[model samples]
Target: MARTVRDANPDSRTARARLEPRGKPYFRNLEPGLHLGYRKAAKGAGKWVARHCTGEQAYEVETLATADDFSDPDGLAILSFRQAQERARERMVQRAHAAAGKTSPLTVRDALETYLDFLDANRKSGLDARHRAGAFIYPPLGEIEKLTTAKLDKWLTGLAKAPPRIRSKAGAEQRYRVIADDHELFRQQ
Candidate 1:
């Protein structure tokens, strides 16, 4: 495994200014196949770039943002060393997903929101399902891909153990203790 080393040469404006401008960019290896680069221009501000190895002999390059050389970093147009590194990682991940013919991975919240939108568009009466998912499932689940069968089983068990809340005509709330005989109700839920 190749370890990432810290270098101050490409990190600061003054340090970068001391180096002679050239066609090649100064690179910092983030990992075995990933590199963050600072392409210093002959005049004006330098730009941040990211390089990712796609194959044994193939590499892909992307320009990320402007380096914090002449002005303070705005995080959008200009970036500091750390910020540039983060942006490079994000860009590489996006590229990797695209190369694999996949969209960006969706979080649990995103999936739920999408489903709710679908329900609304179809004019389906899914208000209860939406409420239950938002209040219970949304709080517990994170990324859908990270969830395992065991975790889902545990969550279902917890849901079954909790008392059911009932509302009265007077707009009052009541909690009824969960009973073993009420398995049918939980199963339906």
Candidate 2:
């Protein structure tokens, strides 16, 4: 004999309606600058619907719970997650432009000064000593404010004659070529 399966509730059907309370929820408890309403599915699942204002076009979001949930501590914490993502995206775009050598229309001297400031903030512990030695090896071509490619070439020539003194392990004078061939490549650019 075959057995027949019976419906758990033949009359059951999904219900749909606006889930927000009759009046507007308090402004302080809602996402600032935007109003959203919480909706509940027939199965009691929750979602969020954002609108420019009450009785305006609403955008449905599957993740957020009801307006009551917004009043809870955990809901407030979750709301900040979207805000934080927006801030991070803005910062990343700024950093990408800086890294691409796309500086503002600032003068070269001004750009160099800004770069120096960045170096100072992130300098290594021994950077000052290294810079002092490097300065002796490659003296400034002119007042950094009046620098030109020709003046820079003249300064490099001076280094070729008497490179900065490099001390040996025994503290003896050791002469080493400080000007690399590639030095001219940078000057040309």
- If scored against the real structure, what TM-score would every candidate get? 0.58, 0.24
| Candidate 1 structure lDDT | 0.81
TM-score of 1: 0.58
Q: Alpha carbon lDDT of residue 3, candidate 1?
A: 100
Looking at model 1, residue 152 earns an lDDT score of 89
lDDT of 1 at 121: 81
Put down candidate 2 lDDT per residue, 1-189, tens digits, no spaces. Answer: 899963221111121133333333212113432433334444443344443322345532223333232333244333333432333344344544576675553344455555566777787634664455345532453125456788668767876777556555544555664655696874864
Question: RMSDs, each prediction?
Answer: 11.0, 18.3
* TM-score attained by model 2: 0.24
Error of 1 at 126 (Å): 31
Tell me how candidate 2 scores on lDDT: 0.42
How far off is residue 111 in model 2, in Å? 6.5
